[model samples]
Target: MSLSSKVRTLKELPLYLPRRFSAAQRQRNRRNAARPPAQGIVVGLLAQVCGRLVKAGEEALRIPERLPPSAQRVQEELKSRGYPHRVVETEETTRSAEEAARAVGCGVGQIVKSLVFRGRDSGRPILILASGANRVDVAKIGKLAGEPVEKPDAKFVREHTGFAIGGVPPVGHPERLQTYIDEDLMRYGEVWAAGGTPNHVFRLAPNELADMTGGKVAVTK
Candidate 1:
């Protein structure tokens, strides 16, 4: 099937993945992706939220077949959401903000990192969309959520969000984790987010993206 025709829901990821992934890791990720989606309302209900707002014209980021699981997952999620995307694969994983920006030829500030944190009291997760140039002040973010927010461990991220660290998208979590968008991201005309995977990213307009995710935009130091 063509890339466009093959993808359905966020669950249909195998159709887009490459045939040769590291045997051990590939098997593990496939299992995780196939599991039933955990019960939780997709926070925002805007139509074509990802595609309509994040991708535009010739600037769309392509999803490569050999991308890391996180990047691959992001591509499929965006595609499922109706966004046109292309995955840019790299020889090595772009696990950090600097590497992701370098791979896409953008400034560190333009990279939009999809971060997950656990609220101390509510036990609900918080997804923070912050600019690469900025750091998420845990105290400030925690205050916004009306609780102390702590970053969940890798196991917690996967268990709660379904997707692992590098691949978590801004939306599509098991629960509608309280979300925040840094005002700094809006300063750029375009921002890049993990395609659901670390190796891939999709460009988005900050304002429209905030609308799509239903995240309150705030200042983060």
Candidate 2:
């Protein structure tokens, strides 16, 4: 029989059972009659517990459709520029290139690493969009920029890019920065970039990235 039917039968057992009341059996019959109410109470409690667990599972599966504030800015920028890409936010952290690749289920080479550097002589910010699988050559970038470049602190990165180190995007900076695109990144048809937050990202064509940032394609690695 079905589980519900079984519970129903158990609940009605006290009422349906044959009753016997002889002089010697009277006390034993009374004790037997008292058990069904306790069993019914237990069944009711089990049903309530099962219902609450189902409710909790449903609630855990629901994720908010709205984007975070930082991600929203990136989305708005793409919209204003007439790009069709949408920012995707996830529960997993994509702060590192490896983590980002894992989160998006893409090869590391397909992830764009937005790196910011300080021009040694001019004290200006330089933006380099490199492939995640490639290591940038600072000397080569210095020659291309006409000055040696130095790694900047977290404060310098935030001041220039209007975002944090790990979550910087190619566009939406406070001001236009001298940008460079890694030639290695050009090999990928599509690439993923940070969307202004550690847990946010967006995908786009390599050519579209060059157009959006207006960065010169050069040998960065």
Each candidate's lDDT (Cα)?
0.54, 0.60
- Cα lDDT tens digits, model 1, 1-221, are 33343333223232222223344643443343232221222111111111123222122233344766655665676678786645443333456554554344334444566677777888787777765556567788867888887756778778887776665667556666667777866766555455555544455557757866788889855
Judging by TM-score against the true structure, name the best candidate: 2
Task: Report the number of the highest-lDDT candidate.
Answer: 2
Where's the lowest-lDDT run of ten residues in candidate 2?
Answer: 39-48
lDDT (tens digit, per residue) of candidate 2 on 1-221 = 43334334544221111121243443442333222110000000000000111111211111226787777888899999998776655445666554554443344444566777788999998888776656778888899899988888888888888887667787888899898887877765556567777766666778888899899999887
Error of 1 at 85 (Å): 4.0
Q: How does model 2 fare in lDDT?
A: 0.60
Residue 184 accuracy (lDDT) in model 2: 73
Give the deviation of candidate 2 from the true structure as CA RMSD. 24.4
